[model samples]
Target chain A: MAIYSYDGTFMGLMSLIGFLEDKQINPVAICDKNDLVTDLFEEQEDIKTDEKRARELIGRIVDHICEPAFDRIVYGFLSQINGFEMAIFNYLHLGLTAGENVERLAGDRRVAPLRRLSLRVGREVHRLKGFVRFAQLADGVYYAQIRPDHDVLPLLAPHFVQRFADQHWVLHDLNRSRAAMYDTHQCEIVILAAADSLCFAENESHFRDSWRRYFQTIAIAERKNRRLQQQFMPRRYWPYLTEMAERVR
Target chain B: MILADSAKYDVSCASSGTFRQGRANTLGNATYSGICHSFAADGRCISLLKILMTNICIYDCRYCINRRSNDIRRTLFTPAEIADLTIGFYRRNYIEGLFLSSGIVKSPNDTMELFIHTLKLLRHRYRFNGYIHVKIIPGASAELVHQIGFLADRLSVNIELPSRQSLAKLAPDKTKESIIVPMRQMAGEIEMYKMEKKKYRHSPNFSPSGQSTQMIIAATPESDYDILRLSEHLYRKMNLKRVYYSAYVAVNHDALLPANPRPQLIREHRLYQADWLLRFYGYQSHEIVSESHPQLSENYDPKVNWALHHLDFFPIEIHSADYEDLLRVPGIGMRSAQKIVFHRRAANLSRQDLRRLGIVYKRAQHFITINGRFEGGQSSLLHSLLSERKIERARQLHFDFNDAPSAVQPSITGEL
Candidate 1:
């Protein structure tokens, strides 16, 4: 009957899970430090992050379970859902105990929540890959902004790096105040301020107007299903889209 | 906007089935799993910058709004202008690639030459490695077609009407031979290039994504059976990647065309479903629609209708049935069937196991028996239940005009 709290980073969480497994002690709950509720009778443990220990734990999981299970754990952490740390800890506990056959227990109640949360995060990552719209800055860098429901900036870097290998781009996650900057050779994540003073290229609005005109013209009058359109590209993403900027005007 | 609105009648905007890895010093690459950058209000995927190169036409096709007789403003984008626009849009990730089509300006060769110039500028000058789909004007010479095919990823030649008689009545300028000859040539060249690539590792790919064609539905008297058979022939004989069905939009009024045209979206949807059956489900066209039944029933889907007509195939044992047999059962798609085969090897499956595999057990319960026990009703009761579900689904498919807001409606002039 003990609760373990970590520093809310993925490395910190993995280190705490590694320490618990080494001690062979199961905690009643695992959460971030901010989510801890003080109880007078319950015992609480504060775990510090160890980079080497976290790397070794991730390598062990990849060796014992599967690579996809490792991805699932990372996605679940990125989901930032309440009580997701415990769900991931339980999923890893089952995987380690069940050996290589843990994937067969996917339908089990203990592992289903982790799968669902990971799927939701994966869907948001896929949508942002398509929904991200870049505007040319005066310095010849492609600049785009997104306000996603989950922290998906880490998941979007490898994709854009492969696709836009010849140009410099910056993708800002406005919700989290983080940005992924790519310099045609490497990508780095940094904290960025709001882009109120950023100056765009002179012809940026002209190209945006052309895209808006094309978007408005291609839809057929005979069959208009705005509900379906909104279902795929929700209104929350409209602020950054060049085609939707005309509607605001 | 004028070019895109006029080009909306053409419905072959697919950006999938091609894989080109991103290279250094290049802007983008194409993946097998196509990315839809946006969706139109018509519920269709917007994967490409679908626009016409020029809207001024020499032919007077009765169903087209850009015919010579129409009183509409005309516009033409030069090769440099088109090249710049496509590059600008691609950099912003607003589109997967460019879908370039044009109306006949002075002659077929002249129009095709313009398309070739634009493709050359995009592929050579700008060094764009993304997906590009170009339309082949009918009656274009072989030299021009080959040059265009070498640069573009996919090519298409629209068989505007289904039959020759319909073409003669609507578009007198186009003949059946003019369209079919170039299609046959492209197919032959594609095969030749494939063989050449095997011999030489770096032989240039010819239409690596393959060619596709479009047919307007409800404009002519062609039945669904005719369209399915034509699609079957194109897939087997010409090796087309896709066959798009566009419901006829009556933008122009003429005596030869229908006075009041209705866009039969359900029929178009059903045709796509049947097309999937032909391409992926390993079902022949004759099995789905025969000469006796020349049309698909609007009440039930083609797969369910086939299952209902052949009642002897029901009640298959879930444990012993083959993969193809499992596919024949309702609610078992390609992925679920694969999952069933994979999961059953580890454990004997039950009704709960089937549900966990993502099978729609409500529809599948009537067709499968778990461990030699049937949970479905008698034949008459089962038939009634399936029919009731079908009727409910059909009613839900109809869109209510009153429920939609007025702001979303298209203007009376058909301009956005």
Candidate 2:
């Protein structure tokens, strides 16, 4: 049995899938470079990221399977779950063999786990779109920080670009040390340091105080259900939230 | 703090069903499916910055802490302050928009003028294109209401109580005609604007999200039947997008009002479920609640109650039943019904297929049959099994705030 290892990028994983298809070799397992377990008896192959091969695989998936199904594959890859690369590879394998009708096979064990993981990634993206709080910097740039479980910076750029089109803003994902910066017109991703030294605009605290005041005051005392609150906006996200920051501090 | 805490009793914080794309040089956009920025300790959604212009009031309502007689701190936000705050918050993506409600200061017209002024500054000066929902004081003039309607995305006039008699008893200053006239005028203006948009593409949108109203439940002795019927009337006649039900939280001590009143959350939840049935599931108010059965069953959900009562419609063939019939079943939701319709074309759906379609088979198995074979056991056994699940759910409904994790402690003292 052959074990294929690649760099933990979506492009690298896609290239490995492409290589597997070209070589007609079904791997026993696919692991990220960090997650590789050394086994003396097993054969291991290291796959490098090939942009052309990755693009070809994406084109094939979009043409053979549905477009949304391709989106699910991307979302599933973004989820960063263990063994998800192989899960997505198996799902694509099944989809290619079964043709367009593979999208309807929800009950199939091979496709269901990938679908569920992609759904989770989609839900996290949707939640972060609402939960992201931007604090204006001294330079008039709206700076916000998030620590999402998955790599959602790529998914969130287009939304903020459409919504806050006229403003310069930076959405930093602290977990990944990556930021999506939009300078009123275009958006680009860059490596950003931890945002501890940024100077906020004057009166930023006043608006944040008012928001915290509003958040606190708007909850009915008689129906206080912190469980439900934590269920929707989990406690782990409270530190970055302006309204919940005071409590955490 | 005082304004938002007092306004907390007014539950209508949804910022959905309106689509406004961000324009060039504009600040923000509004989505049709609203985004909840956060959830409060009470488990309520914090979508809009729901606040009041001022907490001081002239009218003395029995259920209000902000009544004329109540001794509470009074503060008002200036039009510029409101505009600045809304724009600042919008730029940060902290809220979908603003839900601006206010207490009647000197008169309805005076208070409405303040709202209109604030809206003007936010719209014209700030160039804000986000969702804005403004409340119309009941006695505000038609011209003022129309002017505000054109500026705001949505407008609402709170019919605080369900019936005219209840309004007279609890809130003596508000009359049924005074509250409803603005609603009717706004509805007419909305219809006219839709027609005008067709004629002239650049016709300014007039309350493009339409109007909605809130009714305080359990404040009076009105049953669920009265509330649902009134909601139906509002939806059918006034063209209301939503009818919010706010469970009464006793804030003031009055001889007429009940002392230490409990917020009927279960009843409110049931009413919202029944309202969904009325709006989406093709069920009428009277069908869900009748004069004979004036209240929804506290033990079971309204859908299950309806399904149990109408056993004659049971054993619906999974393949043969149409979309409407599928929705009528107890455990089948709207999405599952649509999924079944889409899936059955490719293959015959079995019990496993129904389960995979996300149907609650524990409840649906009693009502549905696959290939004319009943997977559920005897009728009595199925009933007992369903009842057991209902009782388990009912037990879980008593949410103790103390049991919540320490991360979400009640830090705000504004709530009464």
Candidate 3:
């Protein structure tokens, strides 16, 4: 009967859901403000993001459903898949009522879509954890640029922060114009207007050359299988991989 | 690069099995689920910085690229140099950690001492906490082996050959006793340390990721039965974390080894599949292979072959079967079986629901029934359809056609 819109943030979506439940109205669709495509038959309303309501709903979701279901909602929101807002709406609607039994309905249509989105997001997060290639910049900060299909920079910060705790680094997502900067002690996600090209350290090329040579020498010539290599490290990731990068000579 | 090339034949590059959080002063951490930084052209994972400390060997193993008589460029990395390289790569996110192996320069004890020195530099001087998988030198003294175990996350000793006779023929200086005695000692020590840690909270860890070993396949005339039996023994009796199977690639030619050696990649693939059945699927080796069928089926996977042989086990009701029974189906993997068991408790599963639950319905549809409705057509002709699908997959992967060394061919699947 109605279409609901928000400001395209996770908090905004959570607030809109909380507002809808309190009002006892089920919208025909839920979407971000920028993504709303109004239909002639349905009335549209934009919900303001309420921090208190969003936090309360999130707390309730973790307490009632499980921590994993909360993670499912967070990752599904990051996936940016089409109709993910509605999928989360339906999933939480069932989850809040069914309590812990929501996840047991894995094959149910309402829950399966959100689960699939979370899985896709999780797979990308795992792949990027390895695929991220860092190069030492001129100022001693290690910098890496990635063009991942999903918004996964927030998910990747904790891993790199723990692994490279003593090093300064920046992981920039070129597609989103955002970066996660680690300053030897803490990590913060920041927005960048335009991430320009960086100058490498004097001996940066030496290590890169050594790595490329080592990569080539490590493969057994008798079992050379490009298809399998491509399957694991897909061609989309090859542009940034030092080993898979085209030889300049 | 020369050291890495010398050590490339080692196929075990796993960086899993230990979860160490990063300390305040340390440089790295480890995850229980391993991460592959990159895949090589051979489709193998390049997890850690897999390289050798040196490429100078005293023994002349015929199948080894680093044998004493072979004329090749030899290289040695100073302990400081290797530590520096590992730290640099770790900071750059190029590797999980280091997998350090070496050719015995003078003696086993000396080589082990050298490895321990590098590990000490990494652990104490550099304060590195990442995963390190070190190779235990066969014939090393027990004290030295125990010293290295405390510094590394995982340890391994390459059996090199499948059997004692093959070891005698190919690696004349090595013996089965030399290889296995160290393996047994390491297993016992790892067990003891685990028990100690269970009681004591602050006990220093000793090879917390446990031990693994590798054996070369097809270089000697050992059947798949011989190789898998040894792997099964290592898993059951030795409490090994993993057993890697490396198909013979003709790096060196000698009278004792096969001439014009075609790498038995397909056979290696089948053995890995069979190895999975043993470790994760609760299958015994004898059930997979025996005196009658010494080799696995080239036309079908080990699970599918077992399913075809035991036809009475099929037509399992997806709704009513236990988790263990669901795993016996050819295509129902551990994850899918768990999902089925979890979801079917709430409501009945339909044919459509199986696909949504992540089942490879193309393969599972033939073995399972939905709501007591048996839809797999003509049980007698089921194997042909499975074998045909497998052959089509093999063609797509471009696994060599001539690699099928087994006597059974696709034409015989109807009889099977």
Candidate 3 has which clashing residue pairs, if any? Answer: none
Location of the lowest summed lDDT over 10 successive residues in candidate 2 chain A: A99-108
Instruction: Give the runs in model 3 whose Cα sits over 4 Å from its true position.
Output: A37-41, A247-249, B379-416
Give model 1's share of reference contacts.
0.67
Local accuracy of candidate 2 as per-residue lDDT tens digits, A1-249: 599999988899999999998888889999998878898989998999999999999899998888988998999999998879878988998888776776677767788889889888999999999999999999999999999998999999988987898899999999989999999878999998895598999988888888877788888788999999989988888998988887787
Assess candidate 3 and give its lDDT.
0.88
TM-score attained by chain A of model 3? 0.96
Number of the top-ranking candidate, with lDDT as the measure = 3
Q: Tell me candidate 1's TM-score on chain B.
A: 0.90
Candidate 1 segments exceeding 4 Å error: A97-101, A245-249, B195-200, B347-353, B378-416
Q: For candidate 1, give the lDDT of residue A109.
A: 66
The per-residue C-alpha lDDT of model 3 at residue B415 equals 39
> lDDT per residue, candidate 2, B213-287, as tens digits?
998888789999988999998998888999998888888878898675678888989999999998889998888
Q: In candidate 2, which residue ranges exceed 4 Å CA deviation?
A: A5-8, A19-25, A33-40, A45-50, A97-100, B195-201, B378-416
- CA lDDT of A222 in candidate 2? 85
Could you give candidate 3's per-residue lDDT for residues A103-184 as a string of tens digits?
Answer: 9888788899999999999999999999999999899999998999999999999999989888899999989999999898
- RMSD, every candidate, angstroms: 7.3, 7.4, 3.2
- Cα lDDT tens digits, model 1, A137-243, are 99999999999999999999888887888999999999899999999889999999886688999999899888888888899978999889898888888888777
| Local distance difference test scores for all models | 0.85, 0.86, 0.88
* Better structure of 1 and 3 per TM-score: 3
Candidate 3 lDDT over residue span B1-416, tens digit each: 88999899888989999999987767999999989999999898999999999999998899889999899988889999999999888888999999999998999888999999999999999999999999988888889888999999999999988999989999989888888999999999999999999999899898999999998888888899998899999999999999999888888878788875579988999999999999988899998899788988887788877876676688899989988889888778999999898888887888778887778777787688898888665433444445677767877988654433232243245332
Worst 10 residues of 3 chain B by lDDT: B403-412
True contacts kept of each: 0.67, 0.79, 0.78
